[model samples]
Target: MSSIFKWEAKPFFDMVTRRQTLQAISTTALPALAGCTTDILDSGKSQTRYTLNIEPIEVSPVEHALFDPDDDALFGNPAQTALAAILPDGRHTTYGYEPLPDDAYVEYEGSYYQTTNLVTGRKQMERTLIRAEPLPDKADVPNDAILVDELNRPAARVVKILHSNAVTGGEGNSAELLREDAYVLRRPVERESRLATGELDGRIVTMTDGGNWAYRLHVTHKRITETAHTTLAIEVANSHSQFRDVVFGSRIDVELTPENLSADVRNLLEDAVRRETYEETVPLPETFEALLTALGLKAVDTAVTGKLLWYDGELYRCALYVNDSS
Candidate 1:
């Protein structure tokens, strides 16, 4: 639920006059309105039908991370398992050794060694290395080398070596200790934007998936005898509804005024204004369809133009305009 404040409606007679001039030109110069007669003296009077125009809206982008760092398959150590060899009769021959693959290089004894002629059980479950060749140093290892842990499993690629230290073993042999970059093995962030447009009950509606969410334009017309009425409803919804409770707040302030309108048309516009204004707090609806019902705004036979201001908190967000003349 949200609070709505009602304010006095102000008129913009200049815009109304401009709309009237445009309507006159559209009716006379355009073939669509041909055969329509307008008496100069009675031009101030309202007529029966009007036109509706819609504009395109944009949505902001959202970002998402691609990986979780705590997964065991990417971060766990595999050096605890014992190496074994598979016999021809399915007997197991266990060996006290690291399970590295043949030709695989590793930084050992302060140098690099390439294993060769590796012997292993089914599915490489047990590995027995025949021999290894000495390499110059870690500097010789390729940046895109196939990295593997002690158990011969795939290891995350190292992006950058932050720090390195030499560790002395019980036999006085030295090994390299490396500090890897934090972003190594992590995928890049992805940004997404979603947009949709459709017609609902003759009204053109466009939706944006962001804080400034929905934009809707509705136009309707009715005719009676020699008089005609046209109504335009411009609706905007922010992301503060029930589905987007994190948006904090949203507000829409609308103003409408009638210019050079006949007595009957003026009365109709006044009634529509009264219906559109809210004097009590109302529950903020989730969907635009529910929002229209909550706001009590409906299309009626009237001649007027409207100005709309949308906001979130004290910041001015968006604006929409409607010009109706008959």
Candidate 2:
């Protein structure tokens, strides 16, 4: 006659790996941050502050389920006996047992028992607590068909079997980790009208003779306040159109909101933008000979001109190879 048995082995450390993975998935949370903007200044004059508000984007959560494991073979066989094994405490070795052909067994409260199945014409052995450990101090157990922790938490112990059946026991559940947040992208919606003297501060204009000139542009606004993520465009115009072109660099203090943007991140983007804007041309001493030698030119007779252009979205290019003698 075929004999039946049951047993439990540390709930199978495999379950431990699965639980750890679940725990990890349960703890990952990332905050959705937003809001970015830039302002432009015209000469010495500043633009009025503006505010813009828009709809916010909302985030949501995802859900799923968990499964239990199987535990069998410890109570159906008669020859099964508990085998001493290492426990979690290391100081003590616990015993684990399964059914065998020679002895009938049953298990309860760390004990074993053997019985006969008269209807089935067979014998069975079982283990009550072959390998059981105390619940973690921070964990709680729960009530349900599934084995849970002290906190009514499920699946503290699990044993997986064929066809994904629970030959033993465990809990299966899923939960969300990241909380929901909203994002709002705003642009300057309105501006206040003010009188201007038509002069901008800290601006350079060239004279008809190609001489350097400095002009202070006047602005109507004394201060400005703007909402986050608002980009402002300021137009620079020369009433006199005296200079063929004006070339100069200026600095302005910009305030950014920390609510949605980190300082380090904004700083990084700003540094990159500044690096691409200006060219630190190292002019070869007034000596044309030095220029020829530096450029690897065969002679100083060739006139070399450099022009740089800046495009939207940080795009830039140089026309260094503009001439052809082929």
Candidate 3:
């Protein structure tokens, strides 16, 4: 993500004066801490803040699945066997059957078939089974029967798998099939409270002359206190109109320090920020990794709040606010 500093000299000085005035009044009016002198009054209080105004010639949206089942045990089978079965109507059909699951079912042509008396060996793999029963007719099929495609995989656009027959060791119980797919393509409706206690890295860029001039800015924040609350803002400069129709977004990965947290806490925070920010959108900027490398700092955890605007042939400014407190 890229960000541009938007401060003007006069306004910046004015803001500082205002903050100083407020600080003076508060310090004089507020009660003093017990056994503490004015010199140490700022102890235990800290803050960090930065602002950026960005103009982009283009915007883009990033799409991601809430949950992907490609690596899930119940959703995938490796080295499985595909065999042909004769239906009650004497029609030949082919399906996939795995030796791992006890149910011994075949999936083919958009349906499941229950298999029995299967004889198997290196050369006997082609022998006919004594009985292969197709699932109850679609009319009789339970309302909850999982909809599988012609490939026998869960047919719905599955976002999550809440409960599954494979997971619970059940047989022929359609209700036990994974139903989390009911929430397919659903967006999160709530924001979760999370902690920012690790390193963060991001890119910065600047553009001027109405999409004709562009350059990068290197930023680094070092010596951040352990367990500090960190927030990130990304700014983008669109110097060309070539990418006008595309939407942009960010993917952030934070590696936590195992020694600094307990297992439970680590798990809770590992992807906490990412889950919330994945849906947020952004633009292009300088490489944050380069900035960190120059500063001899490592990348860590962060949370993102995104703002996007459409370019209207006028100067567009997007602002992202970062507030760090410890």
Of the candidates shown, which would achieve the greatest lDDT relative to the real structure?
3
Q: For each candidate in turn, give its C-alpha RMSD to the true structure in angstroms.
A: 32.6, 46.1, 29.2
- What TM-score does each of the candidates earn? 0.13, 0.11, 0.16
- Runs with alpha carbons beyond 4 Å of true place in candidate 3: 1-44, 48-50, 53-55, 59-317, 322-324
Tens digit per residue, CA lDDT, model 1, 1-326? 01111312234344468677567545545553332333443466644332221111132110010111233332321211111121111122222222223233222223222233323432222111111122234444433332222112221121111111111221221112121111111111100101011111122111112212111222122221111111111112222232122122222232123343445544543443444431211122233223232223324233223322221112122211223333
Every candidate's lDDT = 0.24, 0.22, 0.26
Give the winner by TM-score: 1 or 3.
3
TM-score of 1: 0.13
lDDT of 3 at 201: 12
lDDT of 2 at 214: 16
The candidates, ranked best first by lDDT, are 3, 1, 2
**Stronger candidate by TM-score (1 vs 2):** 1
lDDT of 2: 0.22
| Residue 279 error, candidate 3, Å | 23
